[model samples]
Target: MKQFISALMDAHLPAPDGLQDGMAHTAGRRFDVYRNNVVHSLITALKVGFPTVTRLLGPENMNRVAGAFLRAHPPTDPRMMYYGAAFPAFLESHKQLDQMGYLADVARLELAIRQAYHAGDAPAMPSEHLAEIPPEALLQTKVHLAPAVQVIRSDWPVLDIWNDAQTAQSKAQDVLITRPAFDPIPQALPPGGATWILALMQGAKLGDALDAATTEAPQFDMGGPLTLLLLGGALVSLE
Candidate 1:
């Protein structure tokens, strides 16, 4: 099985020794066709999984990269959606693509979007629930984020690259992805917003998260992140 798998991925490898075509003949030409089909299908899967990467690298470049990618990190999951989960790290280590620092993060963003889109659904917390809580109690309350909420931190302008936002790369862009409806939306987070969200994800209460966020970024504001979470269906429940 191991030898057959190896030959399936690499065209250069000869078919497993003594492999037969069921007619008692060596499977030479028939094996080649089988190998071609498997390689093509895997590459096509990568293109679908990482559409943004395909566009960034162009189809020709993508084909080359995808071919190499499948060999290095073959699909382990039976589900196609779960394929290429390691592709972002693979891109980061790729010698040819290493210079494009933003490419890996862009792939990361795309992966998070796909994850959020497929995440389990939950009812979003209502504004009135929080409104009923006393102002002081609000800080002590813990927020339960939905499964569809994803926070991404990057040292590159990944959101800009994804959106073709032509803005200057003055600083890194942190992102928040939420599946409010059928699709997931990726939006840029305010400074320290990612930190705050990360804190919440780690089971911190609102006030504790605020402290961590403010220490990291004095300009951190709670309104934008809170509103985004609430409206984006990320605020599953507030305890």
Candidate 2:
């Protein structure tokens, strides 16, 4: 019976022949209505989850894209919040949107923001803790990042695009997201900042992370990035 109901929900079962009783037993109209509701709810959830993506694609285009996405990837989990994890990759393969090269990255940035919102919270260590550590041990110390810290890097100007769409003022361009406090909200980091955050997120020591950022960008300023991380609560502690 459960299997039959599942099949019916997926529109896999055909109506059985039974005259007037057919409509009563199948309830085809009701089932269709229910299916439509489910689809609509999922689509609405995706819109909320990826507002920037929707803005870039426009309402009508986003509706079509959302419908196609639903057909291609049906929801597996009962949770609506996590439904659009594959959306970024889906955008990448969509032939119609192939010319919009930055769309996938923009979706990625939005997803990262959602993830950061749900990540576990952690307390940030005071600046004096780093000063207390011996100079020689700094390179060997394992650094920790707050749960709200999310590091995203893309060739496209995803950070700038997100800011432009979300804010009313002008700002620098880069692809990085950091949520300092529950009320402060997330924002983009400057160039090389994301790389530095990535290194620390990977459990690299302070010296190694700084070195990696320097290697990636010759003029990368370690002090500036460190300050940004500290202020954003990205650096939780050192172990």
Candidate 3:
């Protein structure tokens, strides 16, 4: 069964030897149709999973890329939504897509959004919880972010490139993804924002994360990213 299924997925492979339709010798036309349908379904799933990649490559080019990706990385999980986790890395290594270095980052953003959408739900910590902390205690506090929160740091203006698609306005940008309500939203992060959020995500104390952010970005400010995270309900708890 595995060998037959594998052959079905690979166009180069001939229909499994002795494969037949209703005991008749393998029907080339029927086999071709079945193969095409399976390929088409996989491509369609890729298109839906990576809409930004599809928009960037267009339908025809995306189909080609999807076909190659499908062959190289077949779905291992039953859930089709989780199938394209490696596509961003695939794009990075693809020779044909060398010109679009930013495409991989864009795909990563989309993948993060999809993962956020499907993430397990958890109750958000009250925004006032931060206000309740004393200034001295705040430094020692370790924050917990919601499971759906994701930060993507890119050398290229990934969020801008994603939003505009045609013209990228900046050279570099960081993105913060959060699912505050029913849908997930990806917002462009201000300078030092991703650094700070990522540090916090790793279970660093506030003081440590702040120091890391300041070191990473000399002009780092805690206000903006803090507000964004609070408003997005991304803070789940603090220890």
Candidate 4:
């Protein structure tokens, strides 16, 4: 099985050497056909998985990259949704893409959005609950982000690039993904917003997260992110 899979991914490798005449009839034409179909499917999966990367690199270039990517990282799960999770790192390490350093972050942004979109549904914390928390206790309380909430920190304008690769400004940007309903929405985070989110994710109390955020960026306001958290159904609970 190992030999078959190895040969299937590499065209240069023969089809599980020492095959019977019936299977290897016509110099393994049958296996060749099978291999081509598998490779094509995998490449197509990759293109669909990383559409942003595909468009930036162009179809031809994407195909070449995807081919190499498939050989380096093959699918472990039969589910297509789980494929290409490591594509961002692959792009970052790719010697040819040294000039396009932002590609990896862009891919990470897209991947996060996709993952959030597919995440299981969870009820949003009621606004009344947030309002009920006493001012003094609110800061000491911890908030629970919903299953569909995802955050990504990047050193490039990843959200902008994802929205419009051609004209996106070359500036560092962070991203916040939230699924208020059926579709996941991706937006740029304000200064220190990502830091606050990360702190919350790490189990920090609201006050701690705020202190951390404000210390990093004096102007980091809690109103905006809190509004998004409520409106976007990001906070599932608080404890």
Better of 1 and 2 by TM-score: 1
Please provide TM-scores, in order, for all candidate models, with all chains considered together. Answer: 0.94, 0.83, 0.94, 0.92
| lDDT ranking, high to low | 1, 3, 4, 2
> What is the per-residue lDDT of model 2 for residues 67-107, given as tens digits with 9 covering 90 to 100?
78977787899887788999999999999998888889888
lDDT of candidate 1?
Answer: 0.89
Q: Which 10-residue window in model 4 sums to the lowest lDDT? A: 18-27
Give the Cα error of residue 171 in candidate 3, in Å. 0.9
Model 3 stretches astray by more than 4 angstroms: 21-25, 165-167
Please write out the lDDT profile of model 4 over residues 67-160, one tens digit for every residue.
9988899888999887989999999999999999999998888888889989998999778998998898999999989888888888888888
> Positional deviation of 161 in candidate 3, in angstroms?
1.3
lDDT of each: 0.89, 0.75, 0.89, 0.87
Q: How accurate locally is residue 36 in candidate 2, as Cα lDDT from 0 to 100?
A: 65
Q: In model 3, what is the error at residue 78, expressed in angstroms?
A: 0.9
Q: Count residue pairs with overlapping backbones in model 2.
A: 0
Which digits, one per residue and each the tens of the lDDT, describe model 3 over residues 1-239? 77678778877778777667786867666677878988999999999999988998999999999999999998889799898998999999999899999999999999999999998887889888899999989989999889999999899999987887567767898999989986989998877788888889988999999998888888988989888888887888989
Q: Backbone collision count in every prediction?
A: 0, 0, 0, 0
Q: What's the lDDT of the predicted structure labeled candidate 4?
A: 0.87
- Find the 10 residues in a row with the least total lDDT in model 1: 162-171
Write candidate 1's Cα lDDT for 206-236 as tens digits.
9999999999999999899989988898887
Q: What count of clashes does model 1 give?
A: 0
